[model samples]
Target chain A: MQTEEEFRDFILNGHLYYIPHVTIDCAIFGYHAQQLKLLLIKHRNIDNWSLPGGYIKRAEKLLDAANRNIKDRTGIDNLFLQQFKTFGDPDRIQFDKFDKKKWLEDTGLPSWEGNWLINQTISVGFYAITDFSKTRLQTDFITEACAWFDINNLPPLEYDHDEMVQEAMHTMRLHLYHYPIGLNMLPEKFTLSEIHALYETLLGKKLDVSNFPKKLLALRLLKKLDEKRSIGAHRSPHLYSFDKEMYALALKEGLVLS
Target chain B: MQTEEEFRDFILNGHLYYIPHVTIDCAIFGYHAQQLKLLLIKHRNIDNWSLPGGYIKRAEKLLDAANRNIKDRTGIDNLFLQQFKTFGDPDRIQFDKFDKKKWLEDTGLPSWEGNWLINQTISVGFYAITDFSKTRLQTDFITEACAWFDINNLPPLEYDHDEMVQEAMHTMRLHLYHYPIGLNMLPEKFTLSEIHALYETLLGKKLDVSNFPKKLLALRLLKKLDEKRSIGAHRSPHLYSFDKEMYALALKEGLVLS
Candidate 1:
C-alpha cells in the first residue's frame, strides 16, 4: 500500500527528525461485559499481534506520542492515560529470532527500514482507560486488523508486549487500591454494584458484596442521585455519580478502597 | 587518572557489549536530622553537580544497572530502589552547550569517543531511599566530591537532573501516603515522634502532632515495644518497631497514612 511506503520512508529517515532508539507503547484497556479488555493490532502479513504503538517525534513529549498512537488507531481523544513503566531490555527487538529479510520482502520495504526496525529500542509503556463502546477502531496500512481481547485470554503478542501488558495490569491494580479508577470505566451515573463489578473485572477477583459498597461510600467520592435503576426481579438501587470535588479531595488525601 | 581512561574506553566501546543510547540517573534520597537530603556528585572540572548515575550494560537488567550505580557511588548495597520515570527528550545531552572537542582533548579520547559522548541519550530515572548514617560516600574519577545536600537547597545541577530530583521527591511523597517507606529510613526501634518527623520531612510540611501518631497506629504496621524513650522534659514515649506480619498485610491491603 502507498501508506505503507510512506510509513517506511518515515521510518528509514525517522532518526533525522525523531528520537532514535525510543518508542511508546500503549496498553489501552477497556471494561465491557464485566470483563477487562485490551486493544491490540495484528501487523500486516505478520502472524503476531502487538500493542498500539509508535515512535516519538524529535520535539514531542513522550505522553503525546502515546496519545497520538491511541488516536490514530482508535479515534479516541482525551482518554485517561498514564505512563506506568519503561521497558529497556537490550534484546527487546529479538532480531536474532525475527526474519528481517523475509519481512522486507513481504512488505516491500528497503533493507535499511528493516534494519531500523530491528535496532535497539527503549519503549515507554503507557496504560490508557477508555469506554469500549465509544471507540471507532480502524487499522492502518501496517496493521491487518484491530480488535479487543479479554485481558484474561490474550493472544500471543509480539516482542515483550506480553510483559508490558502484565506490568500495566499490575500498575492499574495497585492504582485502583488507592484511587477511584472506576470513574474512568463506568458510566457517568451508576449503582454501587456497577462500580463494584468494574473493580472485580479489573482486579479479577470476587469482592465481598456487603462490605464493598460501605468502603466506597466511606471515601465520599460518589454522590447518591435521586434517580434509581431497576434491575430484573431486584430492588431499585439508587444511582450515584462521582462528586468531582470529593474525588479531588480523595486524590489529595489518598483513599484505600480495598 | 587511569580510572578516567578505563571509564572513557567503557563509554566509547560500550555499545558493542552494552545497550546504547540509554542510561540511568539515580536520585538517592537519605533521611537525617529531621530533614530529607539527596546525594549529589560534582563532576571533575565541570563545576556543575549531578545525580550519581551510570550506563546499563548490554547483558544487565535495568534495575541491576541502577543498583550498580548506587553501589559504585555510595558503596552501599541493598538499598530501597524504584524506577519512577524516564526522560527521553531528544536534546537531553545538550551537545551544543557542552564542549565535546575540549572534553576529548582533556580526556585524551579519540574523535569517535567525542561523537559518542555527544550523541542523544534517553535516561531512566530511579529513586533510592537509604538511611543517611549507613552510607560511606566516595568520589569516582569523574567526580571531585560526593555529598548530601538538603532537598530544600540543591546546587546547580547538570542537564535536567533538577527536574528529575523534583519528580522523584513527588513520587516518594506519593509512595509514602499508602506505603510504609519509613521502614527504610527509620532506625530499627524508634518513637512515634521520630517516625512522624520522618513523614514531615519527606512530605515537606509539618504534620498535626497529635493526629499523626493516631493515624499511623491505625495502620497497625508498628508494634509498641516494651521499652520507652524519655524526653528531656516531657513524658517517656513508648518505643516502637515495625511488625513484620502487619507491615506485609498493610502493603497487600493498602494503607492510607494521611
Candidate 2:
C-alpha cells in the first residue's frame, strides 16, 4: 500500500524488481457460426503460433494478469473469465532448443541469475468467453498476427499451449451442461434454430428437433420473443433470450426433465 | 524416455535442479455424533499449529503428493483423496517479518537455489473422509502431535491454513448435494438411524424421518443389508451399503428434490 511516488521509486530501483519469470496465458474459446473457435497468435521468435499471453508484473494480482492478457491481445475486458488450472511440469517448455541464452548474449542483455530464463514457468490458465465480433485485435512485439481459428482445424501450437487449449475446452464442456454457452457465442436476438445449431455443434451430433425443444421448454430457461427471424423459409421462427434468473436457479437446483 | 540410471542422475544432480515446490495439504474432516471434527498437527517450527503437508517429490504426480501427505500423517494410504483447488497468491506467505532471508539463515542448508522457497508457494488442497477409527497417527521431523479437534473449536493455524479448511468444507458441502459423504465417516454396517443422524449433521438440520426414508429410498443408491445393529435400547435397525455404480451415476446427475 505504498504511495504512487514510492511505488515509482521502488520500480526504478532493483529492490522491487518485477519478476518477469511469471506469465499469464489465456485460452479464449467461443462458439461462432455453429463452430468452436480459439483465439491464437503467431509468435515472431520461432515463427510458431500460440495462445495470447503476457508476463505478470510484481504489483498486479493473478486475475489482473489475465485481464491484461485479454486486453493486450483482443482489446476485450470484463468477459467471462475463469481459472481452469495451472501448468507447472518441468518439461512444459523447451527453451534450451529455443536458444534463449544465445538471444540474450546477442542482445547484450545482462544474464538473468535467477529462474527467469529457465524451465521454472508456472502458467495460470484462464478460460474466457467473449464476443468475437466486438474484439479489437492487436499484435504485440512478440507476435506477428492474431486471429481466431476453428478448434477442429487448429494448427500445431507452440510449447504446451495445445494441451492448455484442450484443458480449457474440457472445462467449457462441463460448464456448458448447465449454462447457456450459446448466448456468448451467438449475437443478441437469435432464432431457435441458431441456438439449437450451436448446441448440436458443441455436442458434436445431430439431435432430433422435436425432442430438443420439448426438453428446453420444460426447463423454461429461455424466453420466447415476439419478433421473428428475417431470414430462412416463409414461416420464420421466433427469437429467444435466456431467462437469466431461471437459468441461474436451474444451474443451482439443476434442470428438471418433464 | 530416458534410461533408469540416466533419469536418476538427471533428477539427483541435474543441470538446473527441479525442486518440488508444490505441496498438498489435507484438512481431513469428519462429523461424529453431533460435533464436526478436523485433523491437524502441531508443527515443530516455532511451535506453531500447521496442516499436514510435505514437499512433492519429482517422480510423483499431484494426486500422489496428496496420498503421500495423508499416508505420512495418518499411516493409512487407502483413503478418499480429491483435489479441490490450488492457492497461488504471490504474497500468500508472511514476508516482512519471517522473510526468505530469515528462512535461508535458519535452515543453514545448501544453496536450494532452484527451490522457489519464499517467492511462490502454490499448494493443492485435498481432503480425506476417514472413519476416525482406523487412523494410526504419527509425528514427523516438523510435527509434534497429530490430533483431531471439534470443528466448532479450532486452534489458530499457520499460513492461511484456516481458509484452506473452510474451502475444503465448502467443497464437501457441494459434494454432499450429489453424493453421500458420511458413509466413510461412520463405521461399517451402520444403523439406519445412525445414517440419518450423520446426514442431519452434514445438512445442519433435523430432517423428517418419514420423508427422509422415502426420498433416500427413491434414489436407489443404497443397498439394504440383512445385518442388524445389536446396540442401544431401540429396535435393531437395518444396515446398508452404497451401490458403487448407482452412487456414481447419482453423483454425476445430481439427485435434487426441490
Candidate 3:
C-alpha cells in the first residue's frame, strides 16, 4: 500500500481483495561468489525478522503471488521460484508476543476479536534462487527493512519462519539431485569445477571431485565445449556449459544426479 | 456429519471451526496384484467425480486433516501419505457448471452470495499409497459414492481434479525413485518379480526388470531371506523383505534408489 488510507482500507477490508487465512511465504536464497544468503524483512508492526511474504490476491495465481511478494520485498523479479511445501500446523504461528493493543490502536480498531488479519493462516512455502550481487533490496510502506543475510549466520527468525527455512533448504537440496538449476546462478560457459563448487555450496557439503561431475555429465545435462580457460601455467581446463534444451527437459521429466 | 442438521451447521458455521479458503485434497492410489488404482468420490451435489478432500479445521494440523479426509471418504486409516503440492489457481474450481439453484433449494437459503462455502479455496494435495484389496469403501454425507478406479482408464474428473491427479502421480513417481515405498502394498516376504511388477504398475511403464531390481536392492532397503520360495517344479526364487529400520530411516532422510 502506498498511503495510510490505502493501508487502513487493506486492514479493514483486505479479504475483499486478498484470500484471508492463506498466504505465500518465500525463502529467497541468494548465491554469488561461493557465498549463500537468505532474504529477510522486518515488518513495520512486528518486532522480529521474518521471511518475505504477503497475502495472495483473490484473483492471483500462487506463483504470481510469490513473484509479487519477491518483487515487493526485494526489488528483484523473475528469479527461479519453486513451491517447496505448505505449513499449516495450528501452532506454527505464535501470536502471544504480538503487540495486540498497539496493533488495534494503530489500525484504529475497537477490538482485535474476529479481525480479518487475526485469523489463523496456512502459508504456502516457496523457495527462490538468485544471485545476490545482481540485485538490490527495496522496501514498501509496511516493510521496515529488507536485506540479505548469510544463510549460515541468520538472526533468530520470527514465528515458524525458522522451520520454513529448514524445510525450504531440504526441498531445494533434494531438488538439486533431480532438477537442473544454475541456469541463472552460473555463467553461460563454465568449467566442471565451477559447477562442482556450485553444487557443493548449494548442497552445503563437499562432493567427490571426479565422481560428481561425471554423474552430471552422464545425465547429458551439460555440454563439453572445445574452448578452454587458463587460470595458471599449463593448467587450462576445458570450458563446459549447460545444454539448455536438456536442462529444460530435465526440469520437467526430472533426472537422478546421484 | 451424520445428520442433515449437522451438515447444515457445517455449511453455515463451518468457517468458525474450519479454516476458510484452505482445504486438503488427497489422491489415494492403491496398488495390488500388478494393478494401480485411484480412489475417487462422487459428491452428491455434483455430477463429476473429485479426489477425497475437505476443509482443514482451525485447530488441526494439516497432516491430521489429511488423515481424516482419507478416512472419512475411504473407510481406511493410517496409509502412507505425503503432501505433494498445493493447487491455488483462481479457476481451479468452476462454479459455472455447479447446480447452484438446486443447492440453495435444498439448503433453504435465499442466495449463495457471500457464503463461506463458496469462497475460492486453495487445496493442499496429498497422495496416499495403499493395498486396494485389503480395504472396503465408505461414503460420507456429502459423498454419493466412493470407489477405486483403474488409474489408466479413469473417467473425466471434476473441476481441476484431473490436473491434481496428474500432479500427484508425477510427484509420487519421482518420490518412488528417491524414497522406499511398498510397506503395506507388498507382502512381508515377496519375490523380486512381485516388487518389480508393483513398480511397473505404479509407474505406468514397463521397466527393465533385471536392472531395476538391482537398483532397488543396492539401496539396502530390502533384506534377502536365507530361504527361497518355490512357484514351479524347478524354479525357486529367493524371497526378500524390507529392512524396516532402513526403510523408516529412508522415509525420513530420503534415499536415491536411482
Candidate 4:
C-alpha cells in the first residue's frame, strides 16, 4: 500500500501519460440552527458561490480527493465523507459552449495533451456531516470567501452544483428516514425535544412526539443522561447521547431507528 | 438537451474526448431453492467469469448502460435496475501490474490517442433481480458462455467484480429489510410460503413464519389474489402479487418491510 505522502506526491506530479480532466467536489452538509446547511466558497473568477471542490490527484482515490478537498479548505480531515452518487451527464461541464480546448485556453492552466477533455467527468459526490463548531475555515488562492448557507435559501450555485446539492438532499431525505443523521450536528448531550427538533428539521415536517419516544426507546440506540435542561420555558426534558455500539449492532441486525 | 441520435453520434465519434471513464456492471442477483444465484459470463481468454457489464456510452446514463448490458445478454430489460454504488479506486483495475494501458494494448482493439486511459474508471454497479425462467441468455463475441451459479458457490471473478457483488449484496440486504425485492424473481403470483421461502433463500437462513407474515402483511406491500397455488403436494396456499402502488409509495418513503 502506498503511504499517504507518497500518494499525494504521485497525484501532484502532473504526469501526461494519463488523462487529467477529472475533478472531485464535495457537498459538505451540516445541520445547524434547525436548518440544513452547505459549505460554499466564492470563487475569484466565477463570481458565483459553489461547493468546496478541487481536482483529484493521480495517486488518490476519488473519495480521497473529496476528503482532501474538504480538509484543505476547512482544516477538518476526520469528517464523515461518504460517496453518494456520480454525475456523468455528457453536458455536465458545458459552461456555455466552452469545449475542452477553450477550457484550457481560458484557465491558463497547463494544457494536458491527449483527449484530456474528451474523457467524460464522472463526479463522485460525497456528503459530510461535520461538527460545525470545530471547523476552521480557510480560503484557497482561487477563492475569495467561504461560508455556510441555509439549504432552504441557497445562493445561485455554479455549473451542475445545484443539481448535485439536490441529489444530496434526496439522499439525505432517504437517510433520515432510516438512520439518525443529525446526531453529529447536535451538541454532545441534547434533550429529547431538541433531538426531535433536529429530526423535524431534516425531514422538513413534524413527527408524532407521543409515539416517537417509544419507538426510539425500543430501538435502544440512545442512552438517557441524568441531566435535564433548565433554561427553556417548556418543561425540562432529559438529555441523551447515541450508543454507538448498540446502534451498530442494531443496524447489523436489520434494525433501523426510523 | 441533445437528441438521442445526436448523443449517440457524439459518443461514437472518433475524436477522443474527456468523458468520464465509467463502466456499468450488474450483479444480476437471483434466488433459487433457498440459494442465492449470480449471473456470470465466461471471459474470452481466461477461465474466469465476469458479471455482465458494458462501458458507459458517452450519451448513455450509467444506469441505462447497465440495463442495456443486461438486456443484451439476458433479453431482460424494463426490470429493476438499481444504481447501488460507484466504485472509483484509482488502482481498482490494477491486478498484477495490469493497468488500463496494458489491458487496452492486449485487447488488440482499435486504440484512440488521449488521456482517456489515465482517466478514472468510475463503475456504476446495479443489481437486477429477474426470474431465471424468463431470461433468454446470449453470449457476445468476447464471451464464451453464460451461466447462473449459486452465489454461495461462486467461481473466481475477474477484476473487482467479487467486491462489486458483495457491495450489491449489502445494498440488497438494506432493500430486503424494508421492501419486497424477490417479486421480480418469482412467478407472476406466488404463495405466501413461497415468498417466505424466497426471503430465506436470500437471507441464507430460516425465519419465523408466524412473525414474518405479520411484518409482511403490516407493510401492505403485497396483494393477495383470489386464486390459490396450482401445484404442491400439500393443500394449495393463497397466492399474492406485489401491490404496485404500495411498493412505489413504500419505495418513495424508503420503508423496508423487514
Candidate 5:
C-alpha cells in the first residue's frame, strides 16, 4: 500500500484482491565476512520489529508472493528463498499492541473489528540467504525502517516472530546439509578453506576442517580450476567453482553431507 | 459437513467460522509387511480419488485440524505427522472435475461462484506414516469411500493432489534420515534384518544393509536386548528394542542417519 487511501482500501477490501487469512513472513539471512545477519523491518504504526512480509495477490503463486516481498524489501533479485514452516495458532495474532482504536484514529476509519485485516490469520514462513553487503534495504509506507541486525542480537520481535526465527534457523541449518549453497554468497572461484569457512559460519559451529571440504568435493558439485591462489611464499591453494548442473541437481533432489 | 443444511451453510458462510483461502491436505502413507500404500478418499460430489483433507476451523490450531481429519478418516491417533509443503498455485484448484452444477444439484445449494469454498485456496500439505493393517477406514457424508491403494499403483487423483503427494513423498523420504521412526511400524523387539527391511521398503529402494544398521546403531538410538528369537537351531538372532529416551531426543533434535 502506497498512500493512506491505498492503506484504507487494503484494510477494507484487500480480501477482494488478495488471499485473506494467509500471509507470508520472510527470514532473510545475510552472510558476509564470516558473520550472519537478519533483515528486520519496523512497522510504521505499530513501531515493532518483524520479519518483512505481506499478503499474497489473488493471481500470484506462493513462491511469487514470497519473491515479491523479498524483492520489495532487499532490492535484490534471485536469492534462493524457501518455505520453512507455517504458523497458524488461533491466538497467534492476538495482542494488545494491535490497538484497533489507534488504527481507527490514525487512518480516519469508521470501524476496525469487522475490517478484513483484523481476522485470524495463518502465515507461511519463508527464509532466504543473501550477501548482506550486496543488499540495499528498502522500506514502504507501512514499514518505517528496514535494516540488518546481527542474528544473535535481534530485539524482542512482534507476535510469534521469535518462534518463527527459531524454526527458520533450525530448518535452514538442516538444509545446509541437503542443498548446495554459496551460489551468490561466495566468490566465483574459491579455495577449499574459503568454502569450509562458509559452511562453518552458516552452520554456526566448528565443522571438522579436514572433513568439510572433502564432503563437498565428494558430492562432485565442485569443479577444480587449474588456477591457484598464492597467499604466501610456499602456499598456493587450488581454487574451485560450483558445477552448475550438479549444483542444480543437488538443489532439486537434495544431497547428504555431514 | 454432515447434512444438506450444514453443507449449504458451509458453502455460503464458511468464512465466518473457517479460515478462508486456507485448507489442509494429508498424504497418509500406509506401510505394512514390506508394502507401501497411500490412503485416499473418493469425494462424493466429484467422484474422484483425493488425499483426505478439510478446512481449518476458526478456533483450531493447524496440527489439531490435521489430527482431526486423520482421526476422522482412519481411526488412528498419535502417528508422527510432518508438514511437507504449502501449495498455492492460482490454477491449482481450477480443475474441470469440481463440477459446480453437480454440487448444487446434489446439495440443493444456490449459485456457487461467489461461495467461500469456490475461492482460490492455499493448502498446507502434511504426511503421516502408519501401519495399514491397523487402521479402520471410515467415511463421512462427503467421503464416498476410503481405502488404501498401493503407492506405485495409485489412480489419478483430483485437484493438485498428485503434486501434493509427490512433494510429501520427497519430504518424508528426506526426513527418514533426519528423524527417528519405526516406533509403531516395527515390532517392539525386531532384528537388525527386520529394521533394515523396513527402511528399504519405506525408501522404496535397497539400502546398504551393512552400513544401514551400523549407522543406526552408531546413533545409539536403539538398545540390544538380552533375549534372542530362535528360528532354527543355528539361525537364532539377537533382538533389539528402541531406547525410548534416545529415540525421543533424536526426534526432537534431528540426527544424521544417512
Candidate 6:
C-alpha cells in the first residue's frame, strides 16, 4: 500500500516522464456461467466506474501498455487482446463535468498535478477475452474496488467508458462471427451447448440450436472427447475441446457463420 | 503559397496551440483504369513521398483532421473515410534518420521549428475511397507534388508510411469482404466484369467469375441499367448501378463475400 504523498508523487512526477495527452483503456471481457462480463474499476473516492486503463510510457509500445494494464489489474498474463479502436473526440475527456482541480485539491495533491490530469487525452481502446474462473481481481492504490459486471447490466461508467464498452462488444461480436473467439473464455473442455451459449451471450441473440452445431462441426475445429457433461434430469451432451492446429487453420481461412 | 519564413511560423508558432505529439495520415485509395491506387504527396526539396497527412488540431476531432487533410490535398469533400488503425510505435517518427534539424536547415526554416518537428508523434491511419475521375489534385505550400501511385508499385515512402499503406490495404480488403465498398471508387454505372475486376484488384486474388455474379446479384444491391459498355473487338456487357436503398440494407446485414 502506498501512502497519499507517495501516490501523489507517483502521479505527478513519475508519470510526467510518460507520453502526455494519451492513454490506453481496455475493455476486458470475460465469459463465465453463460454470462458475458466486463472488468471495471472505481477510484478510491469516485462513484462512477471506468475501464482498466493506464498511460503509455514514453518508450513503451501501445500494445505493451494495454498488456501491462491488464496484468496490473487482474494479475493474469498472456490473455487474448487486440486494439479495436482509438477514441480521439475533442470532448472525450469531458473535463467540463470532471473537476480535476477540485479532485486533486480534495485528495491533498499539489495544484500542479491537476494540469497533467486535466489535459486533453486520446485513448486507444483494447478488448481482451479471459477465462473468468482464472482471473483474481486486485485493486491498486488509485483503485478502491475492481470487479466484473454483467455486460447486459453495467453500472454507470465514467468519461465515455459506456460508449467504449459498447464499441468493444460490437467489435467482439463481429470478430466472433468470423473467428473462433470462445476458446479463450471457455474451459479446457466443454460441451457444444456451452459454447453455443457463450456465442449467444456475446451476440445478444439466440441462434438456431440444430443449425448452430452443424455449422460449427463443418469447420472441423472442435475435437470430441470421450467424456460427457451430465446435468441433472437432462440429456448428457458430449464434451469437446478445440483442435488447436485445425482451429488455427480455420481462423486463417475464416469460419464464416451466418 | 507560403514563403519559407511564413511556413516556419506556421509550424513553430501557429500550430503550437494545437495538440502536440499526434498526427493523422490518410491512405486515400482511389480506383481508376481498373487499378487501385493510393494518393501520395512529396514535400518541397524532399526526394521521398508520403501519405497526404497533417497534424491534429487541439480542438479538432480525429476524423475531422482526416477529412480536412483529404479536402486540402484532393479538393474533394464528403469522402468515404474510416480510421482503420493508430500507429503508435515509439520510434514511428524515426528522428534518428529523419534529422528534423538538417531538413529544416536545408529548407531554410528556423531551428526552433525543428524542436516541434523532432518531438514524438503517434499517427492515426485512415483509409478513404474516392472516385479518381472526380478529384482535382492540389499541392499545398509544403507539398511540391501530389499524385496517385498504383498499389502494386509504390515509390519509396517516408517515416513508416509504406507500412501504413500496407495496413490500409489490408484493412480495405477485409472491409471489402463484408461491405459494399466499391460504391465510392467505381463509376456511376459499370459492367459486372468491371466490378469483379475491381474486387480482384482490391483483394489481390481472382474470385470465381461464374459464382461471383450470382452471389452479388442475390443480395439485390445492384440494379441492371439500360446502358451497356462496349469495347472494340469484344461483346458489349450490360451496365449495372447500385440500388442505394437495398445496398444500405445489405451493408447493415453485411454482404459477406468470400
Top candidate, metric TM-score: 5
Name the runs in model 5 displaced over 4 angstroms: A2-5, A107-111, B1-9, B95-97, B107-113
- lDDT tens digits, residue span A1-258, model 5: 455677777777787899888999999999998999999988767756999888999999888899988777657676688999999998787646576657666756545566776667899999999989988877766667889999889988988999999999989988898899788788999999888888888888899978878888899999999999999999999999999999999999998887
User: How large a fraction of the reference contact set does each model reproduce?
Assistant: 0.36, 0.04, 0.80, 0.40, 0.70, 0.46
State how far residue A159 of model 3 sits from its true place (Å): 0.7
Error of 6 at A51 (Å): 1.5
lDDT of each: 0.79, 0.65, 0.86, 0.69, 0.85, 0.80
Instruction: Please provide, for model 2 over B6-50, each residue's C-alpha lDDT reduced to its tens digit, 9 standing for 90 to 100.
Output: 433433454343343455688787666766688888854444576
lDDT for B145 in candidate 4 is: 84
- Put down candidate 5 lDDT per residue, B1-258, tens digits, no spaces: 455577677777787888878999999999899999999998766756999888999999999889987877656676678998999999898646476656776755665456667678899989999999998887766677899999999998888989999999888888898898788899999999989988999888999978888888899988999999999989989899999998999899888887
Per-residue CA lDDT of candidate 1, range B1-258, in tens?
Answer: 227777777656766766656789999898886877899988766778999887777777788888888788778787767778898776666767877667666756555543555566778899977778778988777667899988888999988898899888867777777778777777899998888888898888888999888877777888889998887778998899999988887665556565
Q: Kindly list the per-residue Cα lDDT of model 3 for residues A1-258, writing each as its tens digit.
A: 545676677777887899999999999999997899999998777778999988999899999999987887778987788899999998887667665546657645444576778867899999988989999898876777998999999999988999999999988988888899888888999989889988899999999999998998888998999999989999999999998899999998888787
Look at candidate 5 and give me any clashing residue pairs: none
Q: How does chain B score by TM in each prediction?
A: 0.91, 0.79, 0.94, 0.82, 0.94, 0.88
Candidate with more favorable, higher TM-score: 1 or 5 = 5
Query: How many angstroms is residue A194 displaced in model 1 relative to the true structure, after the best TM-score fit?
Result: 4.4
Q: In model 3, how large is the Cα lDDT of residue A173?
A: 89
What's model 5's lDDT at B206? 92
Q: Candidate 3: where are CA atoms >4 Å away?
A: A2-5, A45-47, A99-112, B99-101, B104-111
Comparing candidate 4 with candidate 5, which one achieves the higher DockQ?
5
DockQ of each: 0.37, 0.13, 0.79, 0.36, 0.79, 0.52
Q: In model 5, how large is the Cα lDDT of residue A158?
A: 87
Q: Compare candidates 1 and 3 on DockQ and give the better one.
A: 3
Docking class of 2: incorrect
Best by lDDT: 3
Superposition error at B190 for model 2 (Å): 10
Q: In angstroms, how far off is A209's CA in candidate 3? A: 2.0
lDDT by residue for model 2 (A202-235), tens: 7656878887766677678778888887675687
